[model samples]
Target: WFQQSESIIPNHLVSVPHPYVSIVKKCTPFPIEFVVRSYMTGSTSTSIWKNYQDGVRVYCGHTLPEGMKKNQKLASNIITPTTKEEDHDRPISAEDIIKEKWMTAEDWQV
Candidate 1:
């Protein structure tokens, strides 16, 4: 269904045997997952509401202004990337990803 759409990127299937068995082309995945938040919520340390309550001026790579209320809409959308881990996903910054050589600037440019 998605292949019918020109705007959507489709995964290349390598092989298929039965309805339950199928193989797809392997692709290099970004080490971090980008999460965009519009409103403050959640209880984790990385959550905007919790971070704001704790007086965090900067979150991920976005600088949050002072005096923000819980569940309030942010001035703009914020992208918070989290590292995929076995147990817990940890919040990470774009700079950290570049500094740690997780992804190159050119790779992230697109």
Candidate 2:
């Protein structure tokens, strides 16, 4: 996978010693995580499904249309980002992320 995506993104994987153990480079990770969801289902409080069930239409950065079914495939995939700085991940919008200065505007572009 790294070999194929090496041109697009750099990887920190150093080597896979065995089936269960491996070595990796100690690279600093970004504080935000991008979650792609095709289905409206998850088990966490931060999940879209949970939020939707709780009557949240606007989540992260997307405005989900009404009448979506549980575990149903969405019309389009959604990118839900979360902040990893706290003990519990919090849903965040792209604009908020930039506005809050968690990441640079230019860095967000990448």
Candidate 3:
């Protein structure tokens, strides 16, 4: 996979054992991982579908409309942010991050 990716874009591959490699240059760290989802699924109790079904109109930041069903596609893509953790990734919101000073307003806008 690393070799294939290198072929597509040069200068990123770094020498390492199979299943373990690094980028050539160091990179900036982001406070969050932005996830865009088009559909809702009730696979987990805390999933968007379950939350909506449980009368949670607002999630992350998207204001879901009424009459949505399980496995249904949303009106548009929704941005749900999460932060990487030791055990698992936890959901976060842009508003919370901004209010908590995790990210500046300008940085969040970007």
Global lDDT scores for all candidate models: 0.76, 0.88, 0.74
Candidate 2 lDDT, 19-102, residue by residue in tens: 677688888677998999899999798999999999999999899999998999988988999999657999999999999988
What lDDT does candidate 1 reach at residue 92? 75
Best by lDDT: 2
Error of 1 at 19 (Å): 8.9
lDDT of 1 by residue, 4-108 (tens): 542455455665677677677788777688889998777986677787788877778778888778888887788888787778876778898788777898766
Model 3 per-residue lDDT tens digits across residues 32-98: 7787889987556447877787898888877888888888888888888876656776567889878
Candidate 3 regions with alpha-carbon error over 4 angstroms: 1-28, 85-90
- Which run of 10 residues does model 1 get worst, by summed lDDT? 1-10
Error of 1 at 45 (Å): 2.8
* Model 1 spans with C-alpha error above 4 angstroms: 1-23
Error of 1 at 105 (Å): 1.0
Best candidate per TM-score, number? Answer: 2
